[model samples]
Target: MTIDTSDGTPAASPDRPATPKTTPKKTLRPRNRKAQIITVAREQFGRSGYHNVSMEGIASAVGITAGALYRHFPNKQELLAQAMLDGSSSILAILDEVDRTDSKVVFTALVRYGLDNNFRSLLFDQEARNLTPERRTEARAGVREVTSRVAAALRHERPDLSVPDSVVLGWALTSIAFSPARHRTTLPRKRFEALLARLFDVVRTAPALPEEPAAQPQPTSNFSHTSRRESLMGAAITLFDQRGYRSVTMDDIGSAAGVPSSSIYTHFGSKAEVLQAILARGNETLRLGLVQALRNADSREDAIARVVHSYTNSVISPDSAIAILIEETANLPEEAQASTHIAQREYIDEWVHLLGNETADARATVLATISMINDLTRVRLESRQCAIEDLAVRILATQTV
Candidate 1:
């Protein structure tokens, strides 16, 4: 028999078919979802390393399904490549408008762009290694083009500087302008922009890189034998610096160290453990050097100079730990990431303290100086220690506008 159901629909009987209720399907993706996805992807990739971020997380952040995101970007690599290329295009576009001869116009526009796109610097340096070789080349060409244009502009301003020096200075400016991405800063927008503008002048007037010093022989250590664990850590960082951490394998590390893959487990639990150990050692070295730099100072100015020089030396050294520290920290286990970050902050705080101003601008300046040194050193672009140190000191000594 037919009977009425709770909602007044007729219940199905042996001879009656049930009525199917129809509801309108809700649309989940936004009309501008493609651009939205790229924006959020850049933010997440910059905040966390590329391998550490997931397509699902990106989709969720964009308020869409994974399938929808895939429609826009097939994989995370494409998203990274797109994000970097987009940034490159944006910067290049800005340069296209400004008069290359007008230093103020060039600096003003660039600082504004840097503040707006702070994350691009981090993604450009630390995460681009994860891209496919073809995409990496494409992204690299974009970066080189930006560097070339900026160098050309700088050369117009300073007629005496060589192409190499102008490129190096261009990198310094880019690094300083984007330095806030390396660490968080609390300065308000206007103040930050002014600070960067002042730094632009600092870069403009800084002396040309002095001739590179001759390589001096290292003093012989009493202990000739290197520990297996130490050797393993050294090999791993070199590999990590060359290839992104995810691309490297435990077997690759072991082979580089001239040991079997099984031997690595005896020294370290996993590839992650090896990375953690390397970062930990790097942090310790930085702290000890900081303490010594402070302890040996004859005066306040002397202390600042000593610290700057020592840091420049360490950062530019062969297979420097600074690169891996910046790039691979996101790959460490969560607890390790927290501790390492705290230590890094403490290190920066010490520098800020030494600078004798606890203001946000001072902290930002110190961060910028450190980032500029690290960026230049990591790329192996220009290792002129005295020149870098001079520029660093000038950056630190700039008054807020």
Candidate 2:
């Protein structure tokens, strides 16, 4: 016989009551959690700019408390730096995987990779400047490396083109590939890729423009004490374009406008307000110009040419504020961002109408064509007016495959 247990007959408890079996609570390991945090942070930082995204926001996105987020990243800056590094690393890996000897092959690979990893492209373009100087330099080096490789490949394939032309073309093609990142467009992946490849071929075969002195932007007579508010807006746009929205301070804007820092509050409540005003003015400018172009045109083709000329001229004009408006709108406050986007949508819709594109895919193709025109401004080409109009006509006439 067995001896009885001394503790309340627990040895025979199975006969009295059965203990229920429980599953173990699943938990993410530290490495997996860290990876999750980076991925979520990248998406958040890409969607909303670095200044707009908070540590708490990222932590919430990762389904973790802020304290836990600190355990992984010492601060938001570190998180941003790491996110940029991760993106650059991934992009460089893709570049390495491609056959870099063939310009067309490299471009197709990069376009596909950029489209597939659109968020990463957005992060690099929009938020990379938020990093510290040292970190920014590091991120920039990776970009330059990609550009250099592409330029090298172009040199190999297009022996007829000069070194500088090949380099600029490389940059332009990259810009075209990354255009989808800036706009919200839905298309079948295969179709979009094919369209992008066709676009690349068009740009590749297009004759290179001779590098000429860019026309000096005429001095604006609008920036006087009587136009202090306009002066400040102009100053802010320049600063924002040069240093980015997040990097600029109110005092900086004030100083640039030759006004005391305290005086800025008289015109705008906050920095975001200043940005909103700038964007509103830019939207109004473009809208008015487009309306005028439409009124003056004898035909749809003429309207398109006039619109393209108006846009490119505005971009090069000293007082034109569209660059900052296009690039920094994401840094605006939520309400302002919404309104600005609505304005942008109206602009694009007008283009779609002009293009006679009724379907969603056609609308996307129209936007891409517009993007190609915009990208041309990045290179130093002579006769910008004629170049822009010719390109616009060609792009509009070309059917998306």
Candidate 3:
């Protein structure tokens, strides 16, 4: 809605009105051409990915000649790079705000930003391939900013850890979170969150950092077991979520977990075990969240609210494990698959239980309703977030009622 003169210039922001010292009195008032080009490029890049969009295409969209565009940007790469940076400005803003917070906050912020901001994800996943070499490194530097933020948070949260300890663990957290945006578009939101919760539980832990003596036996009875399991699942989720089932090997999981290539067997019998654990924990986490949300529900409306809010919060929140579980369930062993199924069934049964015995006879109808609820919620998470409340209401009316 705001633009500077047709001459290329940055727009005025009340936040940074033209300052006497900052602006020169005679500079032709640096036009909004750069901003205008960025806006048009965003539309073009988003509609057709980087590969499909051309310099001429963007120039045409901006109502300028390709030669005129070169006046602002030396080449298409510079334009693409600038547009990518512009596209991710919101993410940078979020990262800026969270940079001062704890590791828990950083993990939460990264996941929240990735899921809620589709444009951010688009630019994030596309920039490496789309931007020029000079700018690609810059884009990666922004990505590493998240890693640094995570590391700093980890350092403060776990004071006993050394510098290396923080760096390595921060990498783990970033890997777990960074995968979904790069892939997992068709995945359910609740599922995504359960994985995050599971992953957060992972990044929030350390197996007694390398700074500690190898002979020292770390404390076991506290949150160690629970945290390690989630950590393993987090690593597994990243791998399975990124590389499909047939392609991911036990070695891949081990490498992802930062364990010795042969050490994965020390915990689980096979890669199947890894899959099972990730999917099982994912479903269990989701089931418990849904169960807890509906424990006091007395009306269909309340039931719907509790379910939608609970699942949506998890989906929207940084700790999304549910999406990871459902998306990767097929990768698990046969026995693990059963646990995953039971966990999912229990989530729906909890919803059904909230509806009471009256709907018991409507098992088929309830099943259909459950599917609708899941589908609508997932759709809300994936594409149209603005209308999530309306979507949830319609879902409740159709199914819970």
Predicted structure with the largest lDDT when compared to the true one? 1
**Total clashes for model 2:** 0
Q: Which candidate would rank higher by TM-score, 1 or 3? A: 1
- Residue 39, model 3: lDDT of 72
- List where candidate 1 sits over 4 angstroms from the true fold: 1-31, 122-124, 215-226, 399-401
Candidate 3 or 2, higher lDDT? 2
TM-score of 1: 0.86
TM-score (all chains, Cα) for each model: 0.86, 0.80, 0.39
Question: Whole-model Cα lDDT per candidate?
Answer: 0.80, 0.74, 0.58
The per-candidate count of clashes, in order, stands at: 0, 0, 24
Of candidates 2 and 1, the better by lDDT: 1
**Residue range 234-273, candidate 1, lDDT tens digits:** 8898899878898899988888988777678899999989
Q: Looking at model 3, which ten-residue stretch has the lowest summed lDDT?
A: 378-387
| Local distance difference test, candidate 3 | 0.58
Extract clashing residue pairs from model 1. Answer: none
Who wins the TM-score comparison? Answer: 1
- Candidate order by TM-score, decreasing, is 1, 2, 3
